[model samples]
Target: MDRFDQLRILTAIVEGGSLSEAARKLNITPSAVSKQLSQLEDRLGVRLFNRTTRKLSLTDEGGVFYERARAILADLAEAEESLASQSGQPRGRLVVDAPVAFGRYCVAPVLGEFLRANPEVHLDLRLNDRLIDPIEEGVDLVIRIGQMKDSALIGRRLSKSRRLVVASPDYLKKKGRPKTPEDLKAHACLLHSLRRPQSEWQFMKEGGGVESLSLAGAFESVDIEVIRVLAIDGLGLAQLPVWLVARDLESGALEEVLSGHLSPDPDIFTLYPSARHLSPKVRSFVDFLVERFGGERAWWATKL
Candidate 1:
């Protein structure tokens, strides 16, 4: 097998785990894939994979090769694109990933405006609560909430919104508002499994700093919208980022509980794959997000 083809197979195997799955993705048969892997290992003089029934794992040396190979492939792809004229307006399939609630209320609107501005550009926006791996999944950009830790990726902060502890008036009336962090144990605390910092339901203790309080709620949901609905129905207290509860708070569907507690505002960042120089498509899209949501009163900011 050709070295380049071998590298491709290696990447596919790393991502897809099973040889059969990798072959399916690469449009080859399982036996062909095994043959290629064996050839590549012999040529490179290293054990590339430790394969088992459940999955496949790379040898340490194999990981080093995969990283270098991936970079080389990216360079070749860039060269191919560079051969094509980049002088025209940015236009292509820009696959984006973002949190569901943020995508619906924030990214969707921005994307709509972006599409209108750049008629040539098309979007495949996948909105879910899970943290998506852009490189493996072939996503162009991702809008995320919280800190950026992965050194492999690049991130740009778009906005910040404070977290809040809120419940429906009926819920507060029934359960009584928590005056202290200790009181939270007595009430039904609806959790947003996606929110990292506030996942434990933090509170401002009387002295200083913060305290984390455990919770039991009538319902647990991964969907922010469903959590909002449950909170609106007086199911339990929900500690949500202000953006999710602002409209309800304004309309009196939700009431504040233990107001003085929430931690620092949760920062929102538009994360993209690390690159030396970003293409106009990714660059322009991230800039648009900053312009729209970077201001103090940006749309996603918490009002309550």
Candidate 2:
């Protein structure tokens, strides 16, 4: 394999934390990845990694080599990006990630327009609710909701959304609508399993303080969509994002309650690695998304 190719493989192996994961990320067979790594180490005449049956750790030499290799790769990427900018077109693979529900309902619907506009750019979109490190995963951009905690990533605010307490018309008819946050305790409140075992729901008070409720229910799910579906089926009350249940609320399938006691609003953001010269692919996509859904332009937010 070429030296640059070997560098990429080594970087992927270190970042992915395993040969198999690196192979998956590179879209190559694990055996080939192992073979290439072995050849690269043999040619260098030094052990680069300490390997066990289940773990791989870099040796001192490997660490130094990896750092230098990463710098070279970054320089190469910057050069390409500079050239692409001069060409005034984005032409490369763009990897993006977003939360499952938001990706499905909000982001995925708008992807066709982006691809049609930039025919030379290949898009790879991955959807999951789990928080992932975009730098480690080699993702070009990530759409995230809620508070962003990583100062290393450069984030641009796209829009804002809040969790709304809602229930199906039939559910409210049967259980009576909650007059306040305190009334939520007497009803079946769908809880997220991923939250603390004693799930707490906080709401804004009438006078500008916060009221927190410890809630339990017969049903709990890790998936927000599942909870939304249950709430739509008249099963229980659910606290869901405005973007997720806007249509249900409009169609009279779900009704919002305790509007005065809504939860804190969380902003949507697009995050990427801080770079000196941003690639056209990343910049174009971020701008496209902002134009389409940023600020007051979000369809779900507008429905309210």
- Compute each candidate's TM-score over C-alphas: 0.67, 0.73
Worst 10 residues of 2 by lDDT: 295-304
Q: What C-alpha lDDT does candidate 1 achieve relative to the native structure?
A: 0.78
Give model 2's TM-score versus the native structure. Answer: 0.73
lDDT of 1 at 159: 71
Residues 1-304, model 2: lDDT tens digits: 7888999999999999999999999999999999999999999999999999989999999999999999999788667767888987997778999988889988888789899999989899999878787888889898988787858889999888678999999999999999988898899999877555537888877688777789878589999899999999999998888889988988999999988777867789999989535789999999998887787654675545
**Model 1 regions lying over 4 Å from their true place:** 1-88, 194-199, 204-208, 301-304
Residue by residue across 1-304, what tens digits does model 1's lDDT show?
6778888998898888879899998999999999999999898889988877876889899999989988987777666445433773566657889888877876776566799887766678898878777888889998888776756889888778677778899888887888876787888777766565334776565687777766665567777788889989998887777777778888899987767665666688888888534666777788888888886674754333
List per-candidate RMSD values in Å: 7.5, 5.1
